[model samples]
Target chain A: MPRDGTATRTRILDAAEHLVIENGYAATSVDQVLSRSGSSKGAFFHHFSSKQQLARALVDRYVEGDLAQLEGSLEATAHLTDPAERAVAIVRHFEDLGDEIMAAQSNCLYVAVLTERQLVDDGTSDEIVRAVETWRVRIAEVLKEALAATGAHDVDADALADHLFVTFEGAYLLCRSTGDSRHMRTQLATFRRLLQSLLGPTT
Target chain B: MPRDGTATRTRILDAAEHLVIENGYAATSVDQVLSRSGSSKGAFFHHFSSKQQLARALVDRYVEGDLAQLEGSLEATAHLTDPAERAVAIVRHFEDLGDEIMAAQSNCLYVAVLTERQLVDDGTSDEIVRAVETWRVRIAEVLKEALAATGAHDVDADALADHLFVTFEGAYLLCRSTGDSRHMRTQLATFRRLLQSLLGPTT
Candidate 1:
């Protein structure tokens, strides 16, 4: 793809994601996305064959960006050899995400997309499921490493990872509905405490 | 409300709610609702002046029904004078709700409604916020009683209540996305364990 072509593609995807989050996928039309992106119909057609294709691209971009961010956060703590410290670092990264969510005017795009997945095609829905699984596995790897480093014998890393992921989503819903970031902060703190307790004295 | 008239109104509301959950607030049209409901345009107009009105009524009905169910669950455990028992009973009630959510084969109405609230009116959004607060306060009261009973002064009843609420919403999201109810069961179990740990030995 040419540079401008890539730029236009990104612009269109950005507009679609924003509109989908604001008005929902079913209500957001291609025309609206074009209008919002200030791109011509020809450009959109050149980039994506159809609205469904556009949706798929949007989710793909979302997942890629999400994973990249998670990897970047983990990489920031790569120098730390201790698993417990790395685990704490992971929690800290999520806390930063919670802050970003609170500061952002809208709810998470993945959440909106997931809620409206019934209206979307199976490919799109499968992408979302895979995205979630990918997140779970990535987080679990760090937690498992932390457990190994700490010599913790009793903890279930997979279950704990799922618990953390679910709680984070729950906190997002609460924060979005209540229009209060304090709840998110408190929930993160509680999870941090739980982790600390489980790990036993975060050295 | 006359008997037949009330029945018609309920029929319309039920259809609207179902459509909204399956689709979304923005995508679900009055026409679709009418067609599914087998109700006439005149009846829809008579029951609700506009689509917005119908949406409002749907949310109002959801909140009312939700509060009633919650109160009923709390009342069921009213006989338990011990605060710890009451707290545990409350968790069990939520577990039952998790079961109901799983069995429903769709996401929670409130979750859908809240996600779509940004597209709805401010009044609708405020109603959702209030409904969430009502749930939190009611659950917190029970947790507070348990804290007092057990002399467990360390736990913040309000925060814990919010956690439970957030976790429930998150669990709903997870279950809806994965098409699996086991994640919800696990989240609930983790919450129960947290409560047990805080309350100290469920006796």
Candidate 2:
């Protein structure tokens, strides 16, 4: 593809991502994506054969960007002297996501799609589940670092990470429903404290 | 109402409630309700004026029965001496719902509807929200009593109750997706301990 073709593809992908965020997967249509991107049908189809392919691309883009940024942040604090502090860093990384999600006027479309998911021949739900796996892996890495800090090494890191992933997703949806962040934050606070307690306090 | 008339009406309502719980309000069709209940068109219209009305009735039944059972469980724990213990009691109540949902093979439709709730008209969402409010009130009442039992009368009972309810709902949904209750249980464990800390140490 030429440079212009690549640019057109990126524009259509970005527009589809935003449309899915605003109108949701079921509600958003191909026409909306084309209109939002100012791209012709030929241009759109030249890049994505279908809307699901475009959505999968959005999920891939989001997961890659989110994980890259998350790894950069955790790289700073993973070696902290305090396990609790390391855990807190992980908590705050997700808390920052809460802020971003709220500012972005979304509650995590991955979760929204999951909640609305039904058994179907479509790959949308499959993409949603795959996205969650990526998040779980990200959480697991942070957790391994946190567990290694403060000399706490006995716990199952993968399981704890899985726990955090699900809770965070659930909290995102709950916070969206209530239109408040405290529920999400308090749970994070409580979970962080739990890790601290398990590590027998940093102070 | 005649005996058979009341029987048919109750059957239709029961089926509607089940369908709403299984498939959600938006996804459940009048024809589905009719097929599930073995009721005809005239019978469905005779009972509910619209699908929304059927959902309203399902909410009513859920609030009166399922929600009541949960609220009553929380209320019964009022005699516990510590807010921490009462928190455990509340968590246990929802833990039971994990089984309740599993046995029914139905998702916690409340959480499902809660996430996709914009699709539900305000009037219908209001009633579901009211049902949630009732649950919060019950938990808060128990918190008030339990806090009183421990002589810590000054804590913000309402806020704590709301926190507990939001966590309860979130945890239930998390448990559903993760298919394992260990994480949710531990998170609840941490919340329970946090309440214990707030109560101060016993002599």
Candidate 3:
């Protein structure tokens, strides 16, 4: 069994995530979180000083988890010398990420917060922005490497990387509006093909 | 000058739209709208029955305005018989749309509402969903015509249309997050090129 402190924190976060996604952040109350998490008021205050701090922690934890997943995918493809193959692997990882989001039946938490960014504190908004910028830079580096390996000198790797991330964001929005996963799947396939087209013939 | 009734309604919507986008739906109150719009309680109630009704009217007006803009672009391109040219014209129209959105300095209200869909009622949610579906169908019809004209029968016009809409949504999200219009401009260019690549060289 998990330690008491760790268990309480996880429970609080789980309840917060569900509630925040289910209701707007402004409408969600500390009382609701405490009741949903089944934690004492003292315990709740012990872990988080305020709701804003809790939000910041939630965003930070989500970013860490996402970056770790990305790192694992990159490492798994490290042995491959072909940059195009590595890039394709990274794209596949994103597809898997989409699948996971669909399975969870939740909009991206970062996106959820971003939509209501005006209502969030400046610190929380800054953290979310930085996390997105980090993702773009990391993916751009991968695309740059792939472009170098494939001799696809005409393509702008930075722009392409931004496109990749933006398209995913768009795909997620479509899925949420339509109640369909096919939107994401089809867009990702189109993106994969677009990436593949930038490569020279497979050796 | 516009009629008093027409003028008052527009004033109220302008105020509510600004507040809703600046703050959020839950946070923006009827009192705030009335204060911002400089309309009396009787005038406001005469036009909108409730906050929900005001939101619905705002969304409906926005959608109608958008569809009119799209129709104007399509009409401008009606003389171009070449499918590729027509497709490219449609894309250019979207680029202009991005520019307009950036100039306005507001995220799409539909998207803003979509992010907070869980907090809203079914009627509001249904209206948002229907607006998006309308865009998809209209764009798909254009793509279908293009495909038929070019004999690019292999392309899935429906999926491609959905991609176009999804990319726009994504680009808007990026711009909102980064506070940079360049993000939308670059992604729209990439999408335009993607559409061009689907066509054979201009005959």
Candidate 4:
């Protein structure tokens, strides 16, 4: 209700995201968030009633951002007439975003929640599952269209589609463990090159 | 040490592993491990001086098992003369173990400790980094040989090697979120097929 309410909410969410990513949601407390965000107890409670509420809000924010990126990539590649090139373009689009993604912790929050699913409520958990499925299904459709155009019956479209998600998530995890920022870009580039070869001249 | 000391230690480790995987390391307490393992505080203390010791021990035990499996796969495929075939066979070896892996929580411990590295000791964190590097370097060597044999200069051996790790960790995370056990095997199979295509006709 205050003039600075929106700024205060954004600060809390930003601070909470970093803490949740660094420490699991269960290990992170509202007090820690408040201290990190430099907000008072009144402001914290005003923004989120409970830690559980904060968890849901964090996940909702993350899932929205992820889906927006996915949609933006799809929309960017939608104009390509050849479905094969379209699919390849989508992979390239992600490859281009690899540096930013890696720099921002690379979906670590989504994955942290995923590994710590037992700690969160069902609604928060479902939001994650739904986001994963959205990527899987949407990408699979593009690959299916590509395969149809290429007459490539040797590969299952869904499996190939899932490869993109697998590589993205896996490379980020590797980046975290190894501290190798190049893993994301190089891995995605490898996938894009392979996808192009598999599509084969777009006949 | 008591006569049943070994069994007690095993029980503590098993319970700790499950709890640490389900909830991140920071969230799981020493008391929870004791309760879950049906062991007394005396027994837990007897096995591990503190929770930190248990964390290192867990990673040690897990790394041993993972390396053993990796080595076992390499040994099984050593008879294959073609390095490219050997590499593909190694992936197939893992594909056969997919069911057991998915059943046993699919490397969630490694990824969990990785995400929660801040909560772990330098020794434990180093152990995880070393284990990942071990997999990456060993597999990269084999892939390098395969590429040399096939005269394929387009692909980076390290990138291809990293793909296996990426696909693996990513697919497991997907499995956790989506409840799709098939992602592991299907993604690996797809990687193997694509890998074989890339390595085409070993000269």
TM-score of chain A of each: 0.86, 0.77, 0.87, 0.91
Best by lDDT: 4
Which ranges in model 3 have alpha carbons more than 4 Å from their true place? Answer: A119-121, A148-154, A198-203, B118-121, B145-155, B200-203
Cα lDDT of model 3 by residue, A31-60, tens digit: 999999999999999899998888877888
- The better candidate by TM-score, 1 or 2, is 1
Error of 4 at B51 (Å): 0.9
Candidate 2 residues A1-203, lDDT tens each? Answer: 89999899889878877666544565567998899999999988888888767776777676676567657667766677555577667766665555565665545555444444342234554544444466567766656766676455646566566556555665665565555656666555545544554544452
- Fnat score for model 1: 0.49
- The most accurate candidate by TM-score is 4
- Sort by TM-score, best first: what order? 4, 3, 1, 2
Native-contact fraction for each model?
0.49, 0.09, 0.44, 0.72
In model 4, the runs with Cα more than 4 Å from the true position are: A1-3, A119-121, A201-203, B1-3, B201-203
Give the lDDT of residue A118 in candidate 1. 57
Give every collision pair in model 1.
Answer: none
Which lDDT tens digits does candidate 1 get at residues B167-186?
Answer: 77777777877778777767
DockQ of each: 0.48, 0.27, 0.53, 0.67
User: What is the CAPRI rating of model 4's predicted complex?
Assistant: medium
How do the predictions measure up, each by TM-score?
0.88, 0.76, 0.90, 0.94
Q: What local distance difference test score does each model get? A: 0.75, 0.61, 0.74, 0.82
Candidate 2 stretches with Cα past 4 Å from truth are A1-24, A32-44, A51-55, A69-73, A117-123, A127-159, A181-183, A193-199, B1-28, B141-160, B166-203
Q: Which ten residues in a row have the lowest lDDT in candidate 4 chain A?
A: A115-124
